[model samples]
Target chain A: MRELLRVSAPVDLGAIDPRSTPGLPEATAGEHRKGWAREQVALLGAGLGRRQEMLYATAKAAQERPGPADRPAGRVLLVLQAMDCGGKDGTIKRVAGAMNPLGLHIRSFGPPTPEELRHDFLWRVRRALPPPGYVGIFNRSHYEDVLVARVASLVPEAVWRARYDEINDFERELTDAGVTLVKVLLHISYAEQGARLLERLDDPRKHWKYNPSDIDARARWDDYQAAYAEALSRCATDAAPWFVVPADRKWYRDWAVAHLLKETFDTLALGYPAANFDLGRERERLRAGEAGAGGTGEMNGR
Target chain B: MRELLRVSAPVDLGAIDPRSTPGLPEATAGEHRKGWAREQVALLGAGLGRRQEMLYATAKAAQERPGPADRPAGRVLLVLQAMDCGGKDGTIKRVAGAMNPLGLHIRSFGPPTPEELRHDFLWRVRRALPPPGYVGIFNRSHYEDVLVARVASLVPEAVWRARYDEINDFERELTDAGVTLVKVLLHISYAEQGARLLERLDDPRKHWKYNPSDIDARARWDDYQAAYAEALSRCATDAAPWFVVPADRKWYRDWAVAHLLKETFDTLALGYPAANFDLGRERERLRAGEAGAGGTGEMNGR
Candidate 1:
């Protein structure tokens, strides 16, 4: 599944069918497909939880040990990118929902503040990276500098054009520092997006998520698609490849992302850290109920 | 159930049985009790998730409106304090596990770093408060100044003694500023602590969580209990009340915390924010597929 979705060659966004489920078993009924995908997501989520615990445990052990600060313990960063109403938020709610919040760090990037805009584009991205033992997710990320900036003319052509190598170098540096990157682009068709926007408008419950500006962005769909194609082709690298998931079907999109994460964790082969102290002595102390053995009289006067 | 667990009057730690299932249905078989409690926790968790979404939606709506910066929208902070092996981590995993990670912010405070120690005890706590519309959780919280510091003499008695009022004043400020606080103490018996510690030593999988210092802390269980009783009594307030959930039974503890959170959210009576835009116009535009309506020609030159 990872290989099927991964971008090794140039990306042509128009060629990929947003409604197709490529690797999953075909179903005659929509309900069957949705149910199967949901079950798969849940099963994969449980595995991801166990693996994340191991990753967190390993990092904790490394912190306690006397060693170089740059010791390579596994950390993961899942980067999600999509257009307005592209299910980025929904994907996070479902995929990250399965993992323990203790081992997850999620950051959503909106329009930059004045302070963030003053720094280099990568400055905020660097700050939001996961520490050595957790999975950090970017709901939208540095890729926006190239995508939105390019399509909206927020930066000059030359400036946005130069970010591809800059992004590749940045991702390579992260991979070298023990951060596994899973970059996903939720691929939803223009017609599907219109339907989703209409649904949001019709349902008062979803009003908080609807924005007037979304229609403005939708009007330039072809321009954004071209920008995405360029970004996907140029930024996809060996160390940090891109996976474009057909995201019109919500269940299939979620299952695909969870599957990608599970595959990444499996490659790390993480496990519980061994006990560093004397196991036999600790067992004896616990059995003896040694109330006075380590008494330091710290609380005695009180 | 909320009234049963809430700390309103002077707390007597000795009067509460750690093994008691106060308001839940009693079952002759342990498995039956566990199953029932699990189902209730799930049901309560689902309700909590919906209410949280409404809280988040309300905050988002408020942000878009022109209003005072301090305009009230619901925010929640769940502070959990427990002795070693009292199920603080497990409770968070089961209870917070049921909510969308998008609406949750969890921070676990370990021993203070030198920089943290330099600041007033509440400095870090202030920084960790949930922003408007989110539910923030503290695995261990500011009450530690009165619990661990008081019991271990980490600070002079005069200093730790003064923190009770300081904490109350700070909590009052949070509530006044529109943050709701749910303070919980996972109450486990001394014998249960010993059993849990022994289990950690017995299972290699649990070894990473074990620390030799835990036994040292266990040695002074009674002193710690006295300290907890004092903290609970002094810090309990109407705005930010304390709930002592008997935590020896993991299932009941999770359910109780979920129930408490559900009740707190219910009190807020949160509903989705109404559409602030021209809903009818937006619906017409979406239905019309008005591709050129908002075209700015930003992407045309490229």
Candidate 2:
């Protein structure tokens, strides 16, 4: 699934169908297909949860043992990008939501604050990176510097264009520092987005999510698509690949992203860290209610 | 359940049985009780999820519409504190884990960093407070200043004693600013903790969570209990009350917290914010794919 969705070469955004379920089993009934996708997502989510726990445990052990300070442990950053009314929020609620919140760090990037704008665009991104041994999710991440900045003329053409290479280089540094990147673009059709927008307008409950400026972006949908194509093509790398998941069908998008996360974690080959202390003696001491054991005050303070 | 567990009057911690299931239904089989409690937690969780969405939506609407700056929207903070192996982590996984991660902010407070120590104890806590419309969780929180600080004699007696009043003032301030506090202490017996520690030592996968200093805290259980009783009694108020949830049973603990949250949100009387724009015009414009409609760029740039 990763290989199929991955942008290994220059890709034409227009060639891909936003409604395609490339790897999903064919079913005559749409409801059956949706149910199958939902089940797949749940199955994949259970695996993802286990992997995330192992990753967190490994980092905690490293912290307790105090190894070389410079050496970094493995971590993950799942970056989600999409157009207005796309399924970024829904995808997060379904996929990342399945993992334990203790080991999950979620940051939703909005327009830059005055403090953020004063520094380089990547500065805030750097600050939000996951610490060692956790999964950090960015719902609409630094990709906006290239995508939105380019489409809306938020920055100069040269500036936004230069960010593609800058992003690639920055991601490479993160990979070297033990941060695995799962970058995905929730690909939804223009017509689907219009329908979603109309639905939101039609539901009083969804009014909080609706904004007038969404139509402006929809009007310039072609420009945004061109921007996304260039960004995905230029920034796709061996270390930090970009996956374009068909997102018009929310269930398929959820399942695909969960699958991507599970597969990516499997590649890490994570396992529970071996106990550093004497197990037999610790067990005896714990059973006897012994005080002042061999460990530090760090965990005790909890 | 709220009234049953709330610390309204001076209370006796020792009189409460750690294994007691206060509001849980009676069942002949232990597994049956566990199953019933688990189902109840899930049912309450579903309602909690909807209320949380409403809270988040209300806040988002206020932000977009630019309401009075001083009047804060409703938000919730769930503070969990317990002895070693008392099930704080398990409770969070089963309860807050059921809510959407997008509107959840979870901060686990370990021992103070040097920077944290340099400021008032509540300084780091204030920094970690949930923003409006979000549910913020503190796995271990500012109450540590009283519990650990008093038990370990980390500060002068006068200083730690004065903090009770200070904490009440701070909590009052938070409540005045629209932050509802659901403070809970997961009550567990000393023997149960010993058993849990030994179990951790027995399992390789659980070793990462075990620390030698845990026994030290366990040995000082009486002092910690006194500290907790005083803190709970002194801080209990109409604005921000404390609940002593019997937590030896993990299922009951999860259900009680979820129930507490659901009831608290019910008191808030949260509902979907009324649409600030003309519903008819917005629906027609969205249908026509109109550009530059009535709202701002905040929701755009997604």
**Which candidate's lDDT is highest?**
1
Off by over 4 Å in 2: A26-31, A69-71, A290-302, B26-31, B69-71, B290-302
RMSD of each: 4.2, 4.8
Q: Looking at every candidate separately, what fraction of the true A–B Cα contacts under 8 Å does it contain?
A: 0.58, 0.61
Which residue pairs collide in model 1, if any?
none
B1-302 in candidate 1: lDDT tens per residue? 78999875578877888888887865534668788889888888888889999999999999889587545888999999999999988988888988999999999999999999999999999998899999999999999889888878999999999999999999999999899999999999877787799999888889889999998888778889889989999989988899999988888899889989998998887899989899988877775554543433222222
lDDT (Cα, 0-100) at B238 in candidate 1: 87
Top DockQ prediction, candidate number: 2
Per-candidate clashes, comma-separated: 0, 0
lDDT of 1 at A141: 98
Q: Across residues B54-77, which tens digit of lDDT does each residue of candidate 2 receive?
A: 999999988887856656898999
Off by over 4 Å in 1: A26-31, A68-71, A290-302, B26-31, B68-71, B290-302
lDDT score of residue A163 within candidate 1: 93
Candidate 1: lDDT of B128?
88
